[model samples]
Target: MQRDFCDPLGYMGTRGGDVTATMAIVPRIQQVRDCAAAAGLTIIHTREGHRPDLSDLPENKRLKTARAGAEIGSRGPLGRLLLEPRPGEIVIDKPGTGAFYGTDLHHVLATSGIQNLVLVGVTTGVCVTSTAREASDRGLNVLVISDCCAEPDPLEHEMAIRLLQIEGGYIATIASTVDFVASVNTLAQS
Candidate 1:
């Protein structure tokens, strides 16, 4: 999962001030993180933080992206991990939507022998879906915790989930946070 918090664009409801959408998923994200900790699962956090050089991206895109990040005051508390990752939990700074892009996420996952990834974050149609596609391409089994992901548009969120379900002839599983945590608990017990 990537960029779970921050960025007010997707979090605000129809009423400009309402943040129900973002607030709704915070607990679910916490549940998944807590379950993973209880199960001894390694959790990797990814945040979009472009470099000052802006060499990773084209000039046109770089300018707009940097401005948006700055406008949101991402460098302050908003940019920090909402659920501060515990020590030893890997935190990656990604240049793009997919965690694997412009990062050593692939190498880290491979070296750590992680075959299955559980994706949970904001903007299902964007970052979450992009990461899922990338993970599928890299031969990792992907599971997205639907409830833990939020999109400004309900239909867009559903569409993203459907796309992930059958992408590139590979199937990615979708489950609610409750179900996912239950499965993790079962495995831990067994």
Candidate 2:
């Protein structure tokens, strides 16, 4: 679970080019995070950051340029972790759009025996959607808690939802944060 979730302002301080901020999603992510924690689910966090040495990647000069703009290595706005990673929670530093991109996220999930990915995060049009698509492609069940992800603009958020649900080839739903928590609980029981 990400404290930033989908609110780029809180994480990035600036929406960059995005016009509006979805502040509403934060609380839902908090609720889902709490519920998942109580259920003993292994919480994994993926943040948009790159190591200063760029040891995390060895290709794509364009990626280098992009990371430079995002200040992936520096303790910029996005680098400040609002929710500190707790013991047993894996914190993966993702250098690319997809959480699994340029990271050991797949290996981590496989080792942890996570068959389903309850994905909640920011930039609905970008990182969150990309992660869901990749997860689905890899045969991992992915549930994108719709209300739990936000974009800097509402229209983009809505567009992302449509694409993910209609053509992303994943089982997606527009679940509120509370409903997602309930589902996790129910899943744990079953």
Candidate 3:
């Protein structure tokens, strides 16, 4: 099956938001990138859009996000993708936590004949988990890269990863970055 690595809400730098924990996942992200390349897989990177037109979001949410310093279109560094996506790699700007929401990701996956997804990124309990659920509901096999995902609270991150492992009638699988990379390498060799 054609697999894709889905990175959601990977905003880097403190100016964008709390990235201290997320920073630890950068090298793991690079490992995933290398594995994808070797396995001839695709990498789908999603960034949350913070454009000035806050009409799409509720007033409370808009206010909260603004207070958090993540105005999508703001000239701030938060609007930027933490990692530089390679040329030709798919970069999706999403309005919500679920990558499939209000985005062309579904169509892109379908057209690309992608059947499996390996999910990673920041705020594991939020965007990463949300996308995993959405992907499961869509009938795509989902594997979450545990070590490549992070949250501000280590407890929350662990709990979220645990919950995701059995979500939607056991729809998701969790793997560490090292194990995932090894598996990918093995697959390539076979």
Error of 3 at 116 (Å): 0.3
lDDT of 2 at 156: 86
Error of 3 at 126 (Å): 0.6
- Poorest stretch of ten by lDDT in candidate 2: 1-10
TM-score of each: 0.83, 0.79, 0.83
On the 0 to 100 scale, the lDDT of residue 63 in model 1 is 65
Model 2 C-alpha lDDT per residue in residues 1-190, reported as the tens digit of each score: 3434333454343535442355566667778888989998888888866677867654674466456464334444443565667788788988888998888999988887888888887878888889988888788887788887877678888899888888544545556677877787888899
Write out the backbone clash pairs for model 2. 5-121, 5-122, 6-122, 20-152
Superposed Cα deviation of residue 152, candidate 3 (Å):
1.1
lDDT string for model 1 (1-190, tens) is 3223434543233224234555578888988998998888999988776666656765666567455553322344333556777888998888788889999999999999999999988778888999988998899999998989877676788888888877453757999988998898888888
Candidate 3 deviant stretches above 4 angstroms: 1-18, 50-55, 69-72, 77-79, 167-169
Task: Give the true-structure RMSD of model 2.
Answer: 3.6
Candidates in order: C-alpha RMSD to true structure = 3.5, 3.6, 5.4
Mark the regions of model 2 whose C-alpha exceeds 4 Å error after superposition. Answer: 1-20, 55-79, 167-174, 187-190
